[model samples]
Target chain A: MLEFDNTERTNLGELGEFGLISYLTKAVEINEPSTLKGIGDDAAVLDFSNKKTLISTDLLLEGIHFDLRYVPLKHLGYKAVQVNLSDIYAMNGTASQITFSIGLSSKFPLEAVEEIYQGALIACKKYNVDLIGGDTSASVQGLVISVTSIGFADEDQIAYRSGAQEGDLLCVSGDLGAAYVGLQLLEREKNIFLENPNIQPDLEGKDYIVERQLKPEARRDIVELLAKIGIKPNAMIDVSDGLASEIIHICEASDKGCKLYEDKIPLDSMTYETAREFGIDPTVCALNGGEDYELLFTIPQADYDKIKGSMDITVIGHITQASEGCQMISKSGKVYPITAQGWNAFKD
Target chain B: MLEFDNTERTNLGELGEFGLISYLTKAVEINEPSTLKGIGDDAAVLDFSNKKTLISTDLLLEGIHFDLRYVPLKHLGYKAVQVNLSDIYAMNGTASQITFSIGLSSKFPLEAVEEIYQGALIACKKYNVDLIGGDTSASVQGLVISVTSIGFADEDQIAYRSGAQEGDLLCVSGDLGAAYVGLQLLEREKNIFLENPNIQPDLEGKDYIVERQLKPEARRDIVELLAKIGIKPNAMIDVSDGLASEIIHICEASDKGCKLYEDKIPLDSMTYETAREFGIDPTVCALNGGEDYELLFTIPQADYDKIKGSMDITVIGHITQASEGCQMISKSGKVYPITAQGWNAFKD
Candidate 1:
């Protein structure tokens, strides 16, 4: 319903509330099986006959969660959805639908908001999740995006962070540290651009790291793959706050301790080399780098045989007695206590 | 756990993310039957058995949705949950749980955050809904609250906007214009307070309207009353954006026309006198002013006999053929086309 002219700036108010909502969601295709009713309702409705429903929410503020000067609106939108969906996948649930709300300042035009919607729709399509009802309002400050993702899983298939047994094998999906290194790259470029707008970012051969920071995907496939192999994780969580922080969550919740192998923590070659160039330890980057959006879960020792050779899975540690405490043993055979200094929600 | 003292400004950083979440929800007591899990996991788990689940999300920005100068943090938290619950009640469903996410600025001490949490927990307890999982992050700007309410209803009991027939009676619960008038009172007092701090708000007996503005309740009672009286609404919506706007939403969605009787519109004596005192039209206030949180629904005329003497429920309009158009007939017998210039989402 909103008509945005490519040649000039178009005010958001010119399109109004109904016009903007319709324009943003016009391309949203609802293919999720449980989505009985989507947009254009007081509340979206779903029918998940017998499965346990899972709900997760995330709020991404403009300046705090992301810097729009370096982060494109499209990437911000897509990453917001991925952030919430990753939570559901961490629960071993299928990411089914998302309701995305954005408060935009008048500083942005209709086209700018549309860019975010396009990216969000792309993530919804890629993850096979439907974009349900959400809201858009005029903000007094910069833009803010809030996404609530809904999913479901069979009662037995569902995983929790409080279920890890002493002998469960901790595993992580994909690599870590890349997203943090990529964020560092972007921040450097942003500073450079502010000093001189004509200088483009020197991001050659950094496509993988840049993509990790800009468009991280949720491990919905890993959730499905685990179920396909008939393995229910004893404990599970998404790798949003690095390997150490996430394991601390599982350990504290399950009332157990863990010994993570520092050498086994997954790190890409680019992440290692880039961290070295920046004078940061690659191991530290992997241990505490947030926003990877990968799945970190634990499977029973008996089920380890089933996923031993899985391509994206890496067994990093094993749960231990509570008295031992959560620690990481370095490749040099030195043990260190694991603490959650990775990402502090309270401290920017 | 984070401790809050009146004299000390406890930085949120003092208690890390896990500590903050644990401290805030330490008092949360879950009594909802559908809540299989709450707060600690990656996502909250729920089971709806054979019922259809409903979900609605709302983002309340600092300056956009509320003014902290006049709006107390406690009331802001309560009203945030109330707003989303109203959407569920409008759908003829019971709100069962809410996940409250807030991006709080460091300007707010840990005590201020706890006050918001206390108010939210109170709302959840009063509504018989569980406080499910949520996240608290640091914001560079002011506080932003995002509430996602989850509800459920039996297949046949759920109401939709597309069900109103030609002869359905449009009904509203409670009086209108009170909230808008109350807001006007607060704004006037705020201006006076800015001019001179010694003069306290002359709110005398205006407590009712002031409460309506600061703390609104969802029409859950109306939904319960209708079911108890064996009456189901043909179509329903919450009166958030004034009566005219809500009726227009119903008409546009149902593809029907409506004739609202101005004389039949319910208004409290205080609301009318207050609007007149401010040199504003009470009808205008009722028709265009927003944030009442009352339920507006259309019931088949056949069910009117059952609710003829219902408490708080007023039948103010009737549905008509699509060609008739949506109009309001004043007491003077003049018909005017209804418009929704109330509460524009894209405008301040």
Candidate 2:
């Protein structure tokens, strides 16, 4: 629970939907020239001129997606926006607006909702995305956040999942599996705190991993950087469901296969050390652990040299023909087929 | 509950998120030339060159917005799309595409989810809108549907709530209070069935009311009719959260007042009879009993003559100066002030 500046806790019921929305969005200012109308209307109006529009939506459920026991409301809010914005970036588009619809039970006070909105506002400010229209309803139980992000790009520049060529080079921006490792740490600490209420969490030097889980950043810079260098990816996907799963998605969609190297999979030193401590393989963590929010894209063999030595990018593998199947090449050169059976939100 | 078509059932868990989405959207055809990309991509790409883009979203919680005991899942799906499209129509825009995000519990079978998807597909087909992209995830409890509708219109054709002027004629498309009356009938029948499972629902004579409640249609035809007649509304809103609430919204936004006539309020004869049978005032139901998905607009008095004789429209009232306040004048010459509060989802 977050410490409230004011001890007077006002229930959400005190302010109905209209009052609550007005109160929270009172200070919201629309600066985008494209945005003709923002909140306070039946629908927001935007003029994208000749540019193509990009749209994506994500729904996050409480208990199913995040546990509020350790995850702060503000970070959850920020992470929610970041997660949705990542989808637009994956399409090589510029995110310009987002609508956040959150349903909460009676357990959340007005202050809590404000905290969540504040964090989301911070994210909108940082990304230069306008907070447009949204709906807030009463939840029967727990919190539910549904974010819809709107973006724009040229028709020729938009990346599709089925555009990868058979021999295209597969590259991923930023390291993988950090957020998944962070989740394990948070869950472990949450269990400890529940067992012994007096013991403080031992998160002394785990800021990097913890932040990765709590407030992951989308790789908008990677998209902009590639564009600046006149390189357009043939196929692209955001690593929201682990590197292996995303690569499989790209392969299946493009009617191709891929060879991801285990040694080439990017894993931070901290992630490796923590995985070893937990008696887990860092490679498996990178493979199965999701929510990395990095761009995993494929480019032509000729264009690979342009991005070869980028500090933030790692050349994980190359695409293969469909008959070859998606496989992972181990350090000892053993092959393993990739599967699409990951990130099951339904799996109890 | 809806009767299952077959004795055999496939659980939603069996297919997982990816398989379920793939199975459901396999037959989704994209006919819109503007739709560059559809369901399989991270984000849908749309080309709306030289047009203003419109966006609207709605979040509906299962228990609050619907009851599965009587409401068919397929109808729920269709109604969800209709409700969202109503907002876009209210803005005088043509809804082109929508993104549906539904979170459901394990209780729902794959067949049940398919039913809902089919209903939404039916609506999409009828409206000539494409189901571009969506997110399907597991819920901890009942169903949660969040739909974001995308639309486009010329700048001059777009309407806003804050454009009404004094002496503008207030009008409504279609009759009101039918949906609320339908709700009462369904609830009574639901209770009767719950008390004795052997007793079937008695919906023989209430076909119109039941359909109004279960499958409300947006006033897209009215919008087309108005466009054909070359009469542009000064201000407009969709009647979702009752007539009174919507009128209040228009009045507040436009900085104007209204004089709604009791006798002029369009209530179908069936709605009137049903409201009396339930010991509720038909006028009150029309005023405050929500979910009617009709268009409520204010047109300049000069344009009133052109729309006065339209069968689907009613000249309910006229806009007044702000100081006059929003009031409903009775047939017996009484006046009542309007307020902006209605539809408390959490209220028992």
Candidate 3:
């Protein structure tokens, strides 16, 4: 588990938009050879040769997807771009360009919009893509941001959840459940503030989890890292939903089953600590909490040695025969079938 | 002035989602040589052996961009896609794919989302592109749809708003004003509906104007028509915000002035008649009314013959030296400088 102190609580307003964007996307490494430009123009340029273009879009509304009283606009902007980019990345293609459509209430000053743009533009520059165009309008409620991303890859290079092999080795990127736990902390702090506006909420020693809630970066690098090691995931998906939910997608699509090791799960130290404080099982948070933005994938075991010692790589499970059913092995040697506890926007 | 009667109303629920989309995008003609497929796949394909990729996006919220009290969802969906595609078309590039991100309210059902997609898919087929991917979420208010379009053109073939040459002939494709008049008619009918909910709308003779309002098509054909005639516009933009507004964009981008002939402005006969009935000047509607989705461009006069006698071509203006100032010449030989009365979502 990774651990960090939450002593630094910078006011997002001080960074401005451009500064925030530059600060956050400063480490994104572009790996796709087809990416003509990653993040700095009216649009990202791509050279797909003769393949068909692929584009996808998504919209995240404030108060609906998040609560602004707890979430920062800069992180919100970053997550918005990450969520859309995940779709493209899931298709095993690199996003070349993106368009941002933003809706702000009259109550929000222009500075708020600028801060959002800062996060967006920073993601663009880090991904090496351009901010081509989008629409802006007024909303009666909270802020709404929609981003559409474009990506390209050869037909053969694309991987879908439908193509996993029964014998494939299932793998996942980085840690899980941090973002959800981060949200928990933010919500807790907000409650404290609501109880008394003058209270400086106790966010001490919770920086990692809080950052996870505020600005979770997409695993664009994992895709590249795997490619660099000459490994192509048979079936891959970004973990926008919980790990169990996404695993079910792979199973349903590939018509296969899986067994995961509970003790082998990756959990950042702060996330585990907070989950314990909240009286929730850390494993449950790891399994049910969403928005990790990690990449879950399967690969042939023949190449397992190549990825084993790598940073943040966890071998939590293995794919089983279809009839085996999806199950997880508990640390106490208990076997439990996974159930869908997905976050459904429709279930008000 | 073109002339027509005003008594037509159509309920969108009649066609549902699939039916409405099929009805509107039935006539889109693909002209770009690099287009691999149009509007039927997870993503549109583009043969990019000789060109660079460009993409853009936009989001339109009901009540903000259009009043559902007047505008139907079918048309709203169609226009949503058209507007994004128009951005690519404005750059003298051919759109190859689109991604739609929709935020639907609980008031809407699954059928409504399909209806919106139907409109989007119809445009995809018409424009010879693909519906790549998109995200859907619940909204707290009315519907909001965001669309991102991907396009391509040779590096040199790409046209920007800044490329208008002095003395170039300013040209417009298709007729205008009908959409604006149609909007006015719909507003009146909406008022009547609010006054008496049981009285069925009196709609019979306003098919042309209503179609203009309910199912406005983008001028994709013009892109092909000009290509077939071997003419690339020196500068181009889709007339979304009315002629006066679009012309101003050209003037500002090109750092040049423009002259327009009021006598040459094209207006549908139905639109002109409706304007008179409403006691509004037909030309004013043409200049200030938006959502025409037509191409307003400038080409060197050397290619004037290429555009002359072309179907739906209008020689409404010419590019002038910067010192000449931007103004329009009326039939009585009076000059009135153009002002951007087009919509500004930010203004109070």
Candidate 4:
């Protein structure tokens, strides 16, 4: 028998629905001047000035989006909020408030719900936003978490994939494909555990990649960083769906072409090595693997020097006129047109 | 075989997602100048001028919120949107935009999703709001629809349940008990069909009550009418949960007492008859059965003369001091304290 450390435990029923909500929203900080009221009312209050408020929603199902057998509930909740916020960030706005609609299954105890709330509250505090209001219901199947994030932006400051100019420099934030590689590693270990339950599956040296998959952060810093540098991206989209697919989207929406350099693609060391061990191409994984939650944007060539040296930014390619078409130049100098190998829940 | 008309057909595939969204939003008219933008973009843009924005969300799941054996999909879609807007109306604000998130079962063809959209679009138009952005994904179990609505109100104009004063007059809009009775009628027909599919649903002469259940409108008109009369409610809440339960909420929030009259509770003639046929107490159903989507509010006595003869207004009670406690005066002259009989999804 193995000793289990269960000393740190609490019951959710100790705090009823209202109490739990109050506890979670205690730390939310209002950064936007437009946020008139954060939490603790029938609804949140927002003053949008003369600017229009933007809102977007996304729902993540437990078994469908992640396997609880591998994901901790805390990380699941944190990642859910982050993913929704990424959409608002992609739209070039600062998230001000969110509504979380949850459908919880009976299999989950109330304690699990509180832990999820703890993580969500932490994210709200970190992002300086509020958990306004949402619906909670019963679902017979797996847990369903739907989050709607509201944001505000000056009309001219808003960015869209359709706005890329003909000769803009295409760039991305940090690295890509680590989360996908992390998923491959987790799946392999789960299989090994199934074969031998007594042995702790080997995951000794994969901290970076695993963390990327479990608790990815939205590039809120990137939004502020761009503003600081006085560079409004010609076009922008968050890389939730791998690098190549996102590039193609920019091309399609902007009616422009892109030529990317293989040598310029950024991949962490662990992601590259893990892809080899899994018998997959590192470049292909970087091009098609998703859930990185990084931003990809295009800035004019004149502004490149202002951002290229920044720690997390990368200049990967340049946008071309519409007639040129989109392609990638390989290390060996062969050009290949980009394709949308992005994740589609409908098809896969 | 009996001749049946199958000629009424609509193909959703012919109208792609964008086309369907456009077709439905075409009828939406925005009367409020604060609505900077509606639909068509990454999000519905709303500029609330000097007023702060209010937002709320709710989810209605099939087989949980409604039994499709009785409720039609179109009505379900319409209700999903209206319920969220009701939250805004409850806050004494005008709804500007709504985002709809839907989870579809694999068994449903694309047309079914479009039908739901058609209903939602019609509701948006009627409310003079915009359809912003939402997530669509597959559900392993059944259909689930979630809607988040945004509205605006001046800091001074925003009314909450916590703002009621002692001695204020309690008022309600339109009639009650109709939706509950309509539901009973639908359930009876559903039972008849299950016992024998050969029987047709004889739903004629029940239009008023049936429509109450299927397509209950948000009391936006009543909100406007109150504004016209310069009667700002001291406190307000929408009666989605029975009138008694909602009264209890107002009491608990405001820390006030109320004296309500059973005879003053409005009920339609058809609804009263249907409740008798179902062997359920009409008053009880009207007071405790859910989903009327009507406005319940309290106003200062000084403004009573301005609204006394208005067609849609019903003065039901008066607010008493907290020590007096919440009670209802029956038609038989007995008084009883109001208890919470609101729908509790968590209490399965």
Cα RMSD to the true fold for all candidates: 2.8, 1.5, 7.1, 3.7
Error of 2 at A84 (Å): 0.5
Interface RMSD of each: 1.4, 1.2, 5.7, 3.3
DockQ of 1: 0.73
Per-prediction DockQ: 0.73, 0.76, 0.33, 0.44
Residue-wise lDDT of candidate 4 within A202-233, one digit each (tens)?
77899999999999999999999999989888
Show where candidate 3 strays beyond 4 Å.
A1-47, A50-54, A152-157, B1-47, B154-157
Tens-digit lDDT string for candidate 1 (B48-128): 999999999988898777888888778888999999999999999999999999888766788889888888988998999
- Ten contiguous residues minimizing lDDT sum, candidate 3 chain A: A1-10
Question: Candidate 4 falls in which docking quality class?
Answer: acceptable
Question: What lDDT tens digits, residue by residue, belong to model 2 across residues B125-176?
Answer: 9999999988999998689999999999999999899999999999999999
| Predicted structure 4: lDDT | 0.80
lDDT (tens digit, per residue) of candidate 4 on B1-348: 112234544443444333454555565555556666554344455676677889888877766677766666667788888888998898888888888887765445555666678788788878887776676666666777888888888788888888889889999998998988888888888888889989988889999998988898998998888888897899999998799988977888899999999999998889888898888889998898878999999999998999988888899999999888889999999999887665555444
Q: Is the docking of candidate 3 incorrect, acceptable, medium or high quality?
A: acceptable
Q: Write the per-residue lDDT of candidate 3 for residues A170-248, one digit (tens) a residue.
A: 8888899998898888888788888898887788988888887778787778878887888888888778778998888
Model 1 segments more than 4 A misplaced: A1-6, B1-8
lDDT of 2 at A243: 82
State the C-alpha RMSD over the true interface residues for candidate 1, after superposing those residues.
Answer: 1.4
Ten-residue region with minimum lDDT total, candidate 1 chain A: A1-10
